[model samples]
Target chain A: MSEITPEEHTQDTRPAKHSGERYFGWTSHPKAGLYTFIFVGVLAVGLALADFFVHRHEYIHLAEFKIFYALFGFAAFGGVVLSGWPLRKLLGRPENYYEPEEETDNG
Target chain B: MGDTLMSLLSHTNPGFIVILAGMLAYVIRGEIPRAVVTIGGPLLGLAALVLHSALSEPLATLNMMDMTFVLYQVERVSIVFGLAFLIAATVNSIFALHNKDPLQDSMALIYAGAAIAATFAGDLITVFVFWELTAVSSVFLILKSGTPEAYKASMRYLGIQILSGVLLLMGATFIMGEYGTLEFDAFISEGEGLSLQDDPGAIFLFVALGIKAAFPLLHNWLQDSYSKATHTGAVVLSAFTTKLAVYALWRFFPGEDSLIWIGAIMTVFPVFFAVIENDLRKVLAYSLNNQVGFMVCAIGIGTPLALNGAAAHAFAHIIYKGLLFMSMGAVMYRVGTTKATELGGLYRTMPFTAIFCIIGAASISAFPLFSGFVAKSLTMSAVGYEHMTIIWMMLLFASAGVLEHSGIKIPFFAFFAHDSGKRPKEAPFNMLLAMGIASFFCIWIGFPFLGGTEFLYGLLPYRDEAMVYLEQSLWTTDHVLTQMQLLVFAALAFIVLNRVKLYPPEKRGVVLDFDWVYRRPLYHALVWTGAVWSKAGPAMTGAALRLSRRVYNRIEATFSPQGELSRGPLSAGMAIWTSIVLAIVMVLALIVGPH
Candidate 1:
C-alpha cells in the first residue's frame, strides 16, 4: 500500500464537504440553536402561565397545583437525559462486542 | 354470477386473499405484475372486510378433526385492528415498491396476512396456526439484511417467536381440557375476557402474549431483530406483530391486574436505554415498546373507555409507527445506516423525508391536533377515572420520556443535529408516497372537525363511551392545555439540557439490554461447559471403565470355577448347611407365594 501523505491523511479524516442542494440551510446557522431554545422557553413559560388563568380541572389531586405537569415534564425529561451518563457507562459496549466471536467462527 | 362472487368474497378471510397474492407474487417475475399483486392483495382484503354482512358472526368456518374452526369472524374491535392492518399493508407495499427482492415481497405479504388471520380468528387453534406462520414468515425480513448479525438475530427472533407459539398451543390445550372448547365466544362473554385467576390456561396465554408484546424482560428480541432487518423489512415489521399481540390480549385477558404495572415498567425502563442508544432504529424500537405499554395498561383497566383507547391507539400507532419506520427506512435507503453518529445534515438533501419524519415525531409525542393525543386521551382519562394515581404519574413521566427519545431525538439527531457533512439523495418516490399517506392519516385522525376522529371513534368497541369522550373530555380546554404543557415543557427541558451540555452525545457502540444475559453470560457459560466436557468427559469415562473392570475381575476371581470354587471338594458339613438354607428358602417361598 502506498503511504498516504500528511495532507491527504488530514483531508481523509476531515468531515466531507456537503455537495447536495441545501434544503434547510437555516438550520446550520450558528444562532439556530439559540433561536430554538428561546422559542421553546417562551412556549413553555406561556403554557405554564396559561395554566394559572385557565380553571384547570384534573382527576388527580396533585395535578391541581400550578404547573405540576410542567414541573413533572421538565424533571422527567432532565432526569432521563442526565441518567444517560451513568447508564451508558453501565451498559455501553464496543460496537463489535456481540459480533467478534461470530466473525471469528465464520472465518 | 356477480351476486355469487360477492357472497364468496364476503365469506373469504381477507388474510387468505393476501396470502394468495403473496404466493402469486413469488412466481411473477415482472416488476409491474408483482407490484400489482402485492399492492392489489391488501386492497382486495380491505374490500372483503368492508363487504362482510354481519358483525360478531362467523362468515366462514371449517370443520376438521371433530372441531369447527371459525376462520373469518369480525368483531368491532377486530374490524378496527383489521382495518388498520390492511391500511398498513397497502402503505407498506407502496413503501417497498422500489425493492426488487421477490422473497422479501412475498414473505412480507404472507406475514401481514398471518397477522390479519390471527386477528379475525374466532378460535385459539386458528390463532395459533397463524401465529406460528407469522413468526416463520417474518424471519425472512431480518434474514434479508444479508449480514451475519442479521442472520443470527433472525434465528433468535424465530426461536423466541416459536417459543411463544408453543406456549400458546399449550395454553390452548389446557383450555380445551378445562373448557372443552377453544372458541373465544365460548369463554369470553360480552364485556369480559377469561379471568386469569379463574382459568389455569390464562397464565400460559398471558406469558405467550407478553413475549410477543415485548413485555419488559422479554423485550430484547424486538430491538435485536428490528434494528437488523432490511430497511423496508423494518417498516413492514413495525406494523403488525406487537399490535397483533395487543389485540389478542384485549380479546383474551382484558382487566388483568398484573398488566398495569408491567406496562408501566415497560413504558419507563425503555426510556433510559433509548436515551443512550446510538442506533436510531433501535431507539424507535424502544419507543414502540413504550407506546405499546400504554395499550397494555389500558387493557388492564378494562373500562369501556379504556378498551376504546387501546383499540384507537393501536390503530393510530400502527399508522404513525410505520410512518416513523418508513422515514428511517428512507434514511437507511440513502445513507446505508441509521446510527445517529453518522447521520446529520440529511435534511439539507432530504427535506420531504425530514418533514414526514417530523410529522411522525409530533404524532408520537402526542402533540395536540395529532393522532397520539386523541388516542392517548382515553387511556389517561380511564386511569384517572379508576383513581390509579401512581399509574397515571408513571404514564405521565413515560410520556415525557417518549418525547425525549422518539419525538425529539429521532428527528433532531437524524435530520437536524450537528452536520456530519455527508450528503445523501432523497428517498425514492414510492417511499415518499407511502409516508405522505401515513402523514395524512396522522393529521386526519387527529385534527378536529375533520371527521377522521369521528370515524375512528365510531369503530370503537364501546362507541358511545368513545363518542362521549370525544364530545366532552377530548377537546376540553384543560385537557389540551395540560397535554401541551407536558410536551412543550419536555421539549424545553431537552433544550435546556442540551444547552448545559448534559445531553449525552451519540456514540458508536451497542447498549447492553436484557439480551446480554443470554448473548454474553449464558452463552459463555454454555461454551465453557462444552469445553470442560470435551476435555474431562473421556477421562472420567475411562476411570469409570477401569473401576468397573476391576470390580468385575474381583467378582470373577471369587466366582471362577476352575480357579477357586472347583479347587476344593464339597464337604458334608457344607452340604448340610446348604440343604438347611434351601429348605428354609422353600418354606418361605411356599408361604409367601401362596399368600
Candidate 2:
C-alpha cells in the first residue's frame, strides 16, 4: 500500500503571471503603504477641521462639539476592535469545534 | 385592444412565471437553455409586474374554505419590493450561470419567485403559502453543496424558517378568527400599521416576521446557514429571504413602536460579531443583519419618510449586499475558502473582484457618493426628526461600525493585508458581469437625478416624502463633510491600531452567539440523556421481572389446586364431612319451619 505525503502541498497551483496582470500590486509595497496611510490621515484631519466652517444644523446636543464626528468615528471603531480581543477569548472555538470536519461543504 | 391585453397580463402572477422558469430549468440538461430560463424568467416576471401595476387593484382572487385569497396584489408598497426581488433574481441567475447544478439553479429561481409572490400577496393565507415556499426552495441551495456541514446547516436553516412560517400561520389564524377575514386590508388599516392593541394576533405576526428578518437573538440562522451555502447559493440567499420579511413587516407591522429598540439592537450587536468573525461570508452575513436593522428601524418609525427610507434601503441593500456576497463567492469559488485568516493579497491576481468588493463595501458603509448614503439618509433624518436621540446615536455608532467591519475589513484583509502565499485564478467572466451590473446600480442610485431622472428616490413607496428629503439633499456640504470625516477617521483608527499592533489578529474559530444555547449545551444534554437511558433501561427491566416472578411463586404455593387441599386423602375426607353437615342442617331447618 502506498501512503500520501504532506510535502506535496508545497507545489504552487496558481497560474503563471504575465505582464500587465498585477493591477494593484503597488498597494503591497511598504513605502506606498506608508504614503497611503499618511495621505488618509491628513485627509481625515482636514475633513474634521472643515466641520467648523460648515454650519451643520444640530440634531443631537452632542453634535455641537467640535470634531464630534471624527471623535465618535474613532472611538466607535476603536471600541469594536479593542473589545473584540476580549470577545475572542470568551467566544472563540476551534474551526472544527462545531463539527468534526472542516471544509466539508464541497460541491 | 390594449385594455384587453393588459387585463390578460394582469391576471398572470409574476411569481408563477418565475416558478415555471425554474421548472423548465430543472428539466433541461443543456447549459444555454438553463441559463436562458434562469435569466429570462425574472425579466418576464418584471414584465408581469408592469402589467399588474397597470391594474389599479388586486386581481386573480381565489375562493377557498369560504374565504377570499387575493393571489395578486399590486399596490404602491408592494411594487417596490416586487421589483427589487425581480432584479435580484436576474442578477443572481447571471452570477450563478457558471455553475452547472440544476438543483441549485432551479431552487434559486423558485426562492426568488416565492419572495416576489409573498410581497404581492394581499392576504395572510397567500403570504403564508409563499413564505414557506421560499424556505423550502432556498434550503436546496445550501444542500446542493453536498457536504455534511451544508446538510446539517440547511436542516437547521429549514427548521428555523419553517418554524417562522408556522408562527405566521398561527398569527393569521388568530387574525381570521377575530376579524372573520384573512384579507390584509381587513386586519391592517390602510396607511396605518398593524395595531397590536387592536388585535393580539399582530404580536405573533410581528414575532414571525422578526424571526425571518433575523432580528437580534433569532438571527444565528442567517450567519450559520448562509456561510455554509455554496458560493452561488450564498449570493442567491442574500437576495430574498430576509428582505421579504422586511417587506412583510413594512406592510403589516409598521408603526409597531417596539421595533425601534429591536432594530437598534439588531444594528449594533452584529457589528461586534462581524468584527470577531473569521469567515468572510459569515462577516457578510453579519453585515447583512446590520443593514437590515436600518430598514427595520425605519419601518418601526412608520412615518412617510421613514417608510420610504425602509423601502429604498431594502432596494439598495439587495444590490450592494448581493454584490458583497458575490465578490466573496468569487473568492470562495476561486480559492475554495473565504476564511479571513487564510486569504490576503488576492488583489494581486483577482483585481476586478477586489475592486467590486471595495465598491460594495463603500456603498454599504454609506460613503458620500454611494447608494447607502442616499437611502440611509432618509432613515437617520427620520430618527432625528422624531427626536429619538439615543437611537440616532446608536445608528451613528453602527454606521462607524459598518465602516470598520464591512467597508475596510473586507477589502483590506482579503486584498491588501499581509500576503498569504497563495494565488488563485481570477473570477470567471459571468461572475464579473454580475458584479459589474450590481456595481453600476450602486453608483447609479447613489447620485440622485442622474440620466434625466430621479433614480432610486422615484421608486420609493412614498415618492413625495422621499423627494422632500431628496430636495433637502443627501449631498449637503455639511452632510458630505461629516460623513467623510467619520469614515476617514474610522480608517485612520484601523491604520493606527495596526501600526501599534493593537488590532485583534484574525484567527480560525467559531464565536458563540445565541445559537450556542441550542447547538452546544442543549445538544449535549440530549445526548447525555440518551446515554443514561440506554445504560439503565435493561437493569430496571430485569429487576421488575424478578419481582413479578417471586409474587407468582407465592400465589401458586398458597392457592393452587395441587398445593394443599386437593393433594392429600385427608383433604378429600374433610370436604365430604363439610358437605354432609351442610345437607343435615338444611333438612333440620326445613322441618322446623314447617312445624
lDDT (CA) per prediction? 0.92, 0.87
Q: Work out candidate 1's RMSD over C-alphas.
A: 5.8
**Alpha carbon lDDT at B401, candidate 1:** 96
- Positional deviation of B319 in candidate 1, in angstroms? 0.6
lDDT of 2 at B175: 89
How does the DockQ of candidate 2 come out? 0.49
Per-residue lDDT tens digits for candidate 2, residues B465-506, read: 777777785667888888888889988999889889999999
Query: Which 10 residues in a row give candidate 2 chain B its minimum summed lDDT?
Result: B447-456
lDDT of 1 by residue, B344-374 (tens): 8788788899999999999999998999999
Clashing pairs in 2: none
Point out where model 2 deviates above 4 Å.
A1-22, A101-107, B1-6, B53-56, B449-453, B536-595
Query: For each model, chain A TM-score?
Result: 0.73, 0.70
Per-model DockQ against the true two-chain complex = 0.49, 0.49
